[model samples]
Target: MKVREKKRPFQVFFHDNAVDSYLVTKRATKKVVASIRAAYYDNSSKELDARYRGELLVYQTVKVRQRQAEHAEKFYSVDDDHCDLQVDHGEATKRWCYYFENISVEELSHPMNGTRLR
Candidate 1:
């Protein structure tokens, strides 16, 4: 018998550049964001981490509250059903950048070429 994995809601944060990409329209982006929020609020089991090179990088967000000594920072893992976001490592900068444009639910459901959608 195979053990079943628990499903849980997860959060996704888009990088500033990813949100500004021309390949992603405001309407589409809004839809995606809404879906994620709904899933999380609904308590659905879904990983929220972005995937690259067979590695899972948890999505993280840092929040700072005014006049508050403690701020909350959270990281999320992507659902197995959702396509992990693609990323590229900058050789010059030694940093990782994620791609968000041209990503469709279909693509997320089924990733091809292990690369960013065109």
Candidate 2:
């Protein structure tokens, strides 16, 4: 017998925050400063290290995050019978339930392309 299974989906949350080394004034104190590091890598592994200035390299990092989110969902239908025809009573209903619960266009395309929903 052929076996089929369902898959799970996922999402990624990228945090984009940078520190400015210039100066913060409160109407009373004013100071000038320079950037200590040209660039640095964050925990996300998305940021470049010592290769970029402020915000100039953020677009590249955002693209990485977008790609990651595009392939996050996972799930699949069981078989042809379970997905297409209604053969019997119990099997038909059971398969229908499974089909709705797991089967989706995204899941179907993922295996072939290794990603979900473009």
Among all candidates shown, the one with the greatest lDDT:
2
Give one digit per residue, the lDDT tens place, for model 2 in 58-87. 776788888888755332324565355444
Task: Give each model a TM-score.
Answer: 0.20, 0.23
Q: Which stretches of candidate 1 lie over 4 Å from their true place?
A: 1-24, 44-118
User: For residue 3, what is the lDDT in candidate 1?
Assistant: 12
lDDT by candidate, in order shown: 0.36, 0.40
For every model in order, what is the number of clashing pairs? Answer: 10, 3
RMSD of each: 25.3, 21.3
lDDT of 1 by residue, 1-118 (tens): 0111111011111344453343435545556667767877555233432244213313222222432434222333332224553232242122121223223322455446667667
